[model samples]
Target: MELRDDQPMQHEIGNRTYIVADVDPLDVDGVRTVEVGSALWLLGFLALLPFYGELEANGRVWWLWACLAGFGLGLFGLEYCRRRRKARAERDGLDHG
Candidate 1:
């Protein structure tokens, strides 16, 4: 079904219902990208855990730190974007489900 810009959208899957705020599709895409990027950064940090000792010994632990920083920044960006989208939806009177 086509979604209207003036209203929130609702969908049901099995026994669960989902209420979605209406926002630009491109903004949603960007949020997804941030989420995925954050996950990847976290994964990279975890992958480097086993080599932590060696990296520290070689004074190259900055790589792991960089990944952690990226993960943090990505998470912050994700939340910021999500909030902005929600606020925009609310301002447009599309927040009610």
Candidate 2:
């Protein structure tokens, strides 16, 4: 895969080459985002484990639990979105054949 200085993405696989101009190109950005989001979600979940301690030390706040639940939901949503995109791409490939 070739990322040209002039063009956004100029990649050659086998004998075929693909070129895309100045836009959010499809290569590694999505993968990186997914990885980062997954890590954040994991950390958020870990944060929940310490919430009990925080509750005991300070007063009670249900928002902490809500935030943790939201993070878990976000993780699931991200995974679902990624899977859906991959499944659509695969289906498209099969449709061409």
* Clashes by residue pair, model 2: none
In candidate 1, which residue pairs clash?
A: none
For candidate 1, write residues 1-97 as lDDT tens digits. 7765666478889999999875566545268789999999999999999999999999999999999999999989998988887878888888722
TM-score of 1: 0.65
**Model 1, position 40: C-alpha lDDT score:** 97
Off by over 4 Å in 2: 1-24, 27-35, 60-63, 94-97
- Choose the strongest candidate by lDDT: 1
Superposition error at 83 for model 1 (Å):
0.8
Give each model's clash number.
Answer: 0, 0
Candidate 2 C-alpha error for residue 91, in Å: 3.8
Candidate 2 per-residue C-alpha lDDT over 1-97 given as tens digits, one digit per residue, 9 for 90 to 100: 7765765467888999988566775543154465576677667657766677777577655656665666677677677767766777687684311
Q: How far is candidate 1 from the true structure (C-alpha RMSD, Å)?
A: 10.1
- RMSD of every candidate to native, in Å, equals 10.1, 10.3
